[model samples]
Target chain A: MLFRNILFFMGESWKNLFRNGWMSLASIGVVAVTLFILSVFVLINMNVHHLTEVIEQDVEIALYIDEEATSDEREQLVENLRNHPEIKKADFVSKEEGLERLRDQLGEENGLLEGYENPEDNPLRDAYEISMHDPEAVSSVAREIETYPAVGGVEFGEDVVENLFDFTGVLQVTVMGLMVALALTATFLISHTIRLTVMLRKREITIMKYVGATNWFIRWPFLFEGFNLGLLGTVIPLVGIYFGYESVLQWIDANLKFFPSLIPLETAMGQVIILVVPLGMALGIIGSLISMGRYLKV
Target chain B: MIEAVNVTKKYNDGNQALKKVSFLIDRGEFVFLVGQSGAGKSTLFKMIIKELVPTSGTLKVFGRDVSRLRGKEVSVLRRNIGIVFQDFRLLEEKTVYDNIAFAMRASGASPREMRKRIPQVLEQVGLKKKVYSRVNELSGGELQRAGIARAISNRPAMIVADEPTGNLDPQTSMDIIKLLRNINVKGTTVLVATHDQQIVDELKKRVIYLEEGRIVGDQEKGAYVRAL
Candidate 1:
């Protein structure tokens, strides 16, 4: 009986597909477009999260020491900074190295420094370039470094780091909101499509009822129709998402060489494909079920 | 067996289709409900299938009270009672064989049983050659036979046909009535709602005559005696 019902359902769904050809086409088209847009939004949101995390991992705070401290005291402070639990890596940049870095940034504009007395004569503090286990732990680490007698002050740009973190938070919330809105709109479109399909088959359903068909028997075909629509709709968008992710990855790899590790294109593609098929099926099944529940009662 | 005690159905628009009407039909009996267009014949038929509830009354079919049945119980009741509509209501897109098989499948019949019984039912209805024919391609008589095949496919204990030959000619009407009589002879209670005086007079079966939603006459082996 179960096997017969399944075969009957498949056959009926196929018949309905042909009988309501234009409407079925419209339904499938709507499902495909809505799912495509939703998949794109998910891909964008995930990529943004990946990019933010990569940038966060690269941000480090630099702590400079007081010029009055003796060489040995400065060395001790450097050792202490390296041993801190939060510190991933800590290296001291001598005053000469700092001046050299400034010179390189100034380029040929170093002619302005020629009028000054020996650049080495100017008092400059040695700085520790510190990388921490977590970007969020930077402030506490800075405080600890400031208590050292040899340290002049922590010199990391607190405002810049805080603003970057805040920007990423806002971006995450905005993406989440957009994702929800897209999903709702997709569901609504799919639902409307399925409802139209039901309307087209109303007469056929009434006849089925009078012919002694059970409610589930009448419902199975339409459920299968919805499942097929959802599955078909996911195909194009999943392919588009794959190519889109690859293009973005290629652009980042070529242009943003300074950015730390990029997410591999294959991994992103695999995840998108995994997520899209089920999402498509869910949308299809849910839309069809809702429409059928309201209209197939007879 | 079918029995109704003071069954009443009042539409929401203040139209009382059947008002405290009562009747009884025995197993293997061929009965006719004769009435005018607005005289509640269809309402009584609908009530028998539990499609419409009586405002206040009791209806028992095969010894089970239909008024208290719900969900699957109602469906099960329907499965045991075959119903034919005035419009035939055949799935126009399906072949005759498929339509009959659909009924069997809905009642949860096994495939082996369906394969065995469908051909037998088709031959019984004299449509063995037209089994693969689409309903839209069949004549009025052939379509009615297909409808009969579907109604009787599940071997229901009772068959309720509302205007089974409403759209056929006089000759076709007799053939359809003869088919119903044959089904009746097979021990399935048959209740037909019609105004064909010729058929009623010719069959001379039990007739329940109605006027203004009230039974005016119910006689054993009676003829059509009431006029509009």
Candidate 2:
């Protein structure tokens, strides 16, 4: 197309955008509303995947030593556990050192722990605070250690760990499935909406057909409308998400401080744009193509 | 230049619009296809522009088979032949300039060329002063002139007008035919399909008469034979 033709088509498409004012507005509204929900889920899915990853890497297993185990036996247990293939690090926490950590967690309540200050009064057991190369192997490794004679109990938060794994697994799949469904529904809706606008121009298309206009010439203006509508529709929601997600992240930071750090604003925005803009454009293209196929047989 | 050798078109309902129709139109010739409402005049004109292909026989325009033309090839064929319609099939809400520019742009005329040529054609059609007037604002004659201006604006090798003056008064109708005659005199072939006997008898041009889906008469400077 000539530069002038492109400019003409752009002007024509802009006019078409307002030709059926309510129809165009409705099309844009559909895209914006659909993408708004889509981006929220996409964000949540990303953050959950990120947070679970952080937790998975940092979770460790703690093995408690029996009171009857002598210092030498405790040393042997630690040595044997360190040699375990799945164990990354098996540092021993003595009863006194364990008391120190308890006091740190207790904060102002540490004065109540003064009763256990004497050596004989210390009732805490020696434990091996073990980290693993693979967090998935934590349960199996802890269970095996519990069977050893020197190990009294293994506490890597069995119930909490199982539930966290279950929750992350289900949430990841469900959110991902929901995102795909939303995108498909949005595309289907936008295609049909644009078809109505194209239908309104059936006679105009017939006139163009007889005017010796090439199929491409007849299609260019509509395609331009589709491209721009797609662009504007998807961008509107992304803009909403851009401002909204920032404060939402702030709230999460203030309250869910224990959760792993999330995707930053710029990265998340870039990701959505990259994934979303083309989909939006495709929706418009498919829509106009289908409409034209019916009315523009020439 | 069009050649139709036994061209036939049958509607799906088995109505035979044209039966073994054959005619040859030379370059720079002005021919009027005159017939009753169902005499297949419009269908012949459509075949010339490749809007409707023959059901069986070969119809050639500019020495190429029309039915063989595909996609953009058909558009290229139409660009060489401008068409004017009775109802003034135009972008009605747009200015007279846009209506003419449409045909020019369809053939991919540049902005510079359109700027330079639109006025020239409009001037030739006596519409120079009304270039920006909306099409719906024009009188019947003026609308037909705008239609003629658009037809000639592309500078096609030929012009095809189907009932070009159907809605105009007798005087306006003659004016439109003369305008088309003026275009034809400039050495472009012109084919007009109409039942208007007044202009046909008055103009004394070549007339091809059709009856019952076949050409019943063909004469140089032929007179329209009125139905008894």
Candidate 3:
């Protein structure tokens, strides 16, 4: 009996959808447009998070060791830096290796500083590059490292790190705020549109009530109608995101080699698919449920 | 069977629709509810279906206190009683067969049952040939007959026809009363609320007459009485 009722509701929902083609189309269109806009924001949110990770990698403290210090002293300083609570990693870079890295960067201009090529003649000092778990903790960790005996001087971009933290905090808050607002707006619009379909068939609903239909019996078809509308709304946006994002990633990969940290379309789309389809359907269901709640008083 | 004891309905705007009105309708009984516009006939019908609760006193239908029924229980209560409106309330877009089938569908009747029963009820209402005809295309008399078919399709214990003949001519009205009379003969209780005094005189059925929300006259085989 329950199964038959469900089948009947589903059949009725399908009939109503086709019977009111224009209204159904209009409802689906609303969901599609709203979900498309939401997907775009989700894409932007992923890229922003990716950018934050990339910039976080650059937030390291550079400490120059005293040139006269012994190799044992340098190793002890590296050990102390690593054992610090805030520091995630601490690695020693010899003066010779630093010069080699500089030369590699200079390429053809390596010969411009010919006399300084020798290890003994190299002006660079041995340094301990420190990476911390929290970007905000970098400054405090650097201050602690400065008190070490063999440390010559400590340098890290204080203003740049502070600004990065502020920017990331504000961006995260704004994106989250926008997402919640958009979700609510989408739910509201979809529900109101579905309500139009309910209003059109109110007479039928009343007749059903008069004939002793359970409230759930009357609501099942409407809920299914909402689910169908929500499902249909996601199709275009999913296609756009899957294909459109892939092409954008392909173009970026070809033209912008420097931005290797940007999330690839495949990875981004995995999240999008999981998020978009369910969100669209949920919004659709929520909208329909809200409208139906009013009429189900019968 | 239905019982009403000291039933009073007071709207939020302070208009007392029914004041200390009480009556009993036994099983297999045909009753006529005759009243003017504000004489509380509609309110009484609504209370019987559990649509509106009486502000005071008790109403019991089928041995259950109707005022206490809630949600699904109310639907359960309504299923045993069928109602017909003056306007027919047929879905104009649907055919006569679909309209009758829809009523059975509401109560979770199987498709096989609907198929078997729709034609039978249509035949009873003398619209078996017009089964596939759309409600909008049917004559007023045929439409009322369709409404009757839908109401009796479920075989409820009682049938309430509120001014069923109000929109029809005298000959058609008599035809509808005869149809209701036939259903009553089959032992399903029937109640007809109407202002047509000529039919009341002709049929000589049990009549409960009301004025100003009070029952002034109730007589078996009664005529429509007007106080000078």
Candidate 4:
């Protein structure tokens, strides 16, 4: 653990890492591919989460007012809806707007709505449309609004809102599950690559043991190799992520506008770098320990 | 110093590699453990280093029972006994200087100490001219010399060379044995296990002869007698 021992172990590991050209290269490549797979899933998970958030925003309740209610009472209802803790947004639709929307819907059939053109004759009532920050609370919020004397009825299609929440929750959980499995796969994949290098130098380890090296002394160099392989392997994919991810986002923005807008490059990359780089290093260390376990007994 | 009293090693397959073999090697003595293949010289050497614990009876190195040494204590025991192998066993990819430095580093020598001590070790073994040559690039004699340099770099109290000149030519063998003898003269106890009758007879040091996992002869300044 001293600085001197660390320096020597690092120097020894650096040489052993390249001792077998193909074996070392192969280990690095395996780490890269496994990490790259994990990153792709992470990006997918982030985008899906973003899309679900956008959909949740559109899940609002339409509360029509009783025509018999006074203007002051309608105004008070709008204010209360807006001030509620869970409410994210509220919009008041005047009776005239209600008529206007009906007219637009009946475009080709204008003659049928000719009598209803006047605001007084319009059948639609003034309504307040409100959405909650958490879509899961839609039904409870709708039920609470229904208790208002001035409010006619609340309609937010209970089944659709519940189903949307269910679908998004399942998607997020599945993606997270996949990420855990991928991380484990990356560890084993990296370990297998490191094992080859360990075998190539198995004789060297025995000689080290014969030379009176402590188990730690023999382990330090291989640990260094494992750590380096993982770190270097991450660089390939991170470089792939850093320079290419933004351009991929731009391409999606131009060609697939209907798709949910992906998280901004800077934010997505921050999340990925924090999670993946350490993952790579951890995988490397674990891999090295696994590969070295049987050999260090001498 | 090593002491063995009724030491026996039985493998899992019930084959006894050593049968109550006992001997005492005092400090600063040169001894040749001479035996044929399968005669248990290797097993006895391994027991001294605590690599293989005795199945029965007691074996002590440095006055402590080796069979009772724990993990870290085993390393301490080994560090006190420098071992040489028939194959030279130097890391093929490393230079001679680095090979000896490995031994010093294993024994926790400081960087400054290693730098100061390596050249001296190389000089003692006559490996100074090829100090930077990779092990694979050296001739058989030079490799053996580098191995010896590494074995003595840590200044262990005893040197256990298991067939040190096993793979060398007759002349190289003689030279390696002479170097070991010189190190012994400098007060480092030396134990060499060899089948070479010429070196054993020529040196006429304390010889312990083994046959079929049993010590048949032990004598002061003994010749390579096959227990006649």
Candidate 4, DockQ score (0 to 1):
0.49
lDDT per residue (tens digit) for residues B53-72 in model 2 = 89989999999999999998
Candidate 1: pairs in clash: A66-A152
For model 3 chain A, where is the 10-residue window of minimal lDDT?
A253-262
User: Against the native chain B, what TM-score does each candidate's chain B reach?
Assistant: 0.97, 0.97, 0.98, 0.97
Highest lDDT: which candidate? Answer: 3
Off by over 4 Å in 4: A20-37, A40-164, A172-181, A236-264, B226-228
Task: Tell me each candidate's i-RMS in Å.
Answer: 2.2, 1.4, 0.8, 1.5
Off by over 4 Å in 3: A14-30, A48-167, B226-228
The Cα error of candidate 2 at residue A250, in Å, is 1.8
Per-candidate clashes come to: 1, 0, 1, 0
lDDT of each: 0.79, 0.82, 0.84, 0.83
Task: For residues A1-298, write the lDDT of model 4, one tens digit per residue.
Answer: 7799999889978887777667667768777876786777677667666866776667789998997888788778877887899898888887788777766655665566678776668888888878788888988989988997799878885675456568757876876777567666656765666676677777777766766778898788888888998898899888888777789888876665345577898898888889789988888899888877754555
- At residue B67, what lDDT does model 1 achieve? 84
Model 1 chain B poorest ten-residue lDDT run: B219-228
- Report each candidate's C-alpha RMSD, comma-separated, in the order given: 5.9, 3.9, 5.9, 6.6
Supply the global lDDT for candidate 3: 0.84
- Between candidates 2 and 4, the one scoring higher on DockQ is 2
